[model samples]
Target: MAVVNEGALKKMLKQYKYKDLTVREITNVISQYKDLKPVMDAYVFNDGSSRDLMSLTGTVPVSYRGGLENCL
Candidate 1:
């Protein structure tokens, strides 16, 4: 498994090119942002990739897609 150092995590956030901020990055930055949760309710209709959220935030508790427990 690849460990995400602060620099690496910061790089990933930067790659997103978000001017304001992102929910994912917000979670990463503010660990107080309420712990693990998926990006479903955070969506309206098409919330983009469920897979990406899984990859970015790990399992995303109670998510139907399950966890990427195999990836590591």
Candidate 2:
């Protein structure tokens, strides 16, 4: 799982709040920081169907204590 620096992320978001940021632009910001870089992984369903969470939808799940709590 990728660890994010909340303060840094919030500051960056505030800096770009006035602009219409694209996914790529946001991704670039995240990628620029090591802790904020997203980890690519696949999500598999009970039926054996799987989808790459990163590529399928530029969002990644946030896990805490071995449990998923949210998506980012």
Candidate 3:
């Protein structure tokens, strides 16, 4: 899993609270941080799959701690 800097992201979001931001805009900000770029690039989004949904079951399962790190 990618270790993102939550503090930095929260600060950025707070700054844009009054503005309407698109997903691409937010994604651009995320990609600006070197640490998260690799993880972001590793996945595909908006495909015709339940993985893009907001619910936990709809997204990719977190199996890193269950001896499936390599599979992810």
TM-scores, all candidates, are: 0.24, 0.28, 0.23
lDDT of 1 at 5: 49
List residue ranges in candidate 3 displaced over 4 A. 18-72
* Candidate 3 lDDT tens digits, 1-72: 334454444444443443234334444544543233312212245784433211111122345756533222
lDDT of 1 by residue, 1-72 (tens): 222244444554443556135644555533532333323223234756432222334332342466433221
| Candidate 3 structure lDDT | 0.36
lDDT of each: 0.39, 0.48, 0.36
**Poorest 10 consecutive residues by lDDT, candidate 3:** 51-60
TM for candidate 1 is: 0.24
Tell me which residue pairs clash in candidate 3: none
Q: What digit string (tens of lDDT, one per residue) describes model 2 on residues 1-72?
A: 334454544444443443234344445655543334533366799999986443223444567899965454
**Which candidate gets the maximum TM-score versus the true structure?**
2
In the predicted model 1, the residue pairs found to clash are none
Q: In model 2, where do residues sit more than 4 Å from their true spots?
A: 1-34, 55-72
Rank candidates by lDDT, best first: 2, 1, 3
